[model samples]
Target: MEESKPMLRLKRTLTKGNLWLYILSELKRGRVYAYGLSKKIEKEFGWSHGLITSYVVLYKLENEGLISSEFEGRRKYYKITKKGSEELRKAKRYLQQLLNKL
Candidate 1:
């Protein structure tokens, strides 16, 4: 019997490479609601993931303390926290260094 390699879909989905960076960039602009963020990402980068995915990422980021959110009517508005900004800076620098190596 042959052994099978484990699939790594979660890593790919979560990392999402530069798409995650772009999401951070958009969040840095100001507090944005989920639909707005999704639209911005789609318009700016042509990323067209489902609305649930955007909300899930936002939830994860907030849970990680990288971002903060407030309730507005029936919607939740999200903004980058200080820690999120710091992480964004670090990520940008890391990406730049990686690009330079390439």
Candidate 2:
């Protein structure tokens, strides 16, 4: 029997750790919806995950006060909150420091 590698495990980890960062980055561009976020991630990362993942991340971020959302018709439009901006700044700083060490 052949062993199978767990596909998306690494991606899932990266997404879990960096999901907020990704959402913040997207919001920095402008207000966006879950579907838009999913498409952006797919285009930028080349992964084909569904919109639910993005919605879940957005929901968590909203609950954590990292982001805010408003209902526009049937869709929820999201924006990075002040806390989200700070989180993005911290993540960017950390990433920069790590890259500098490399």
Candidate 3:
């Protein structure tokens, strides 16, 4: 029998800003296009994200200098910069601290 909607686990949907860590972490893996980043987020973290939101965050990060992007033909690939790495470390620590309190 097919599972009913109530019996099925809902897909985890994340708000736009919630993706900072996922993007940064994936960028650490290598440079990534915004589309690829969003797919990886869903695949690895089970968080469903919209393409426009992901690109918005990407542009924000780039503007903040936490990430840099380059155009290869029509694709823009992003990589975390040193500052972004520092921020990622700080974010990890914050998460750790939050978990410890729970």
Candidate 4:
């Protein structure tokens, strides 16, 4: 059995308006499997949910056309789409504005 880990999902670190931004940023690094993504999130962001939660976010992104996935061997790898990159740009702009305001 796998060991249990204490981590919160990406959503927990971001506002509802910015959840996808962080996810897309990670994807920008390269395609990643769900479990791999989750672990990276936990290490980098210091919070990540379980495997099921990670998959749920992946499915949502896939449905929204912000990301795509493919099966490679026994794992499914996910990558950001053009739309996702655009959204990431928007998020960066918004963050810049917010920082400037403060």
lDDT agreement with native, every candidate:
0.78, 0.81, 0.84, 0.77
Tens digits of per-residue lDDT for model 4 on 1-102? 643343334344463334456578889999998878877776877765667766677788899999999999998899999998887888899979988999
Score every model by TM-score. Answer: 0.79, 0.79, 0.82, 0.78
Top-TM-score structure, candidate number: 3
Give per-residue lDDT, candidate 1, residue 42: 80
Candidate 3 residue-wise lDDT, 62-82, digit = tens = 999999999999999999999
- The CA lDDT at 95 in model 1 is 69
lDDT of 1: 0.78
lDDT of 2 by residue, 3-36 (tens): 3456456557667556777779889888888988
lDDT of 1 by residue, 44-87 (tens): 77657777878777878889898889998998899998988999
Question: Count of backbone clashes for each model?
Answer: 0, 0, 0, 2
Candidate 3, residue 55: the lDDT equals: 82
**Root-mean-square deviation of candidate 2:** 3.6
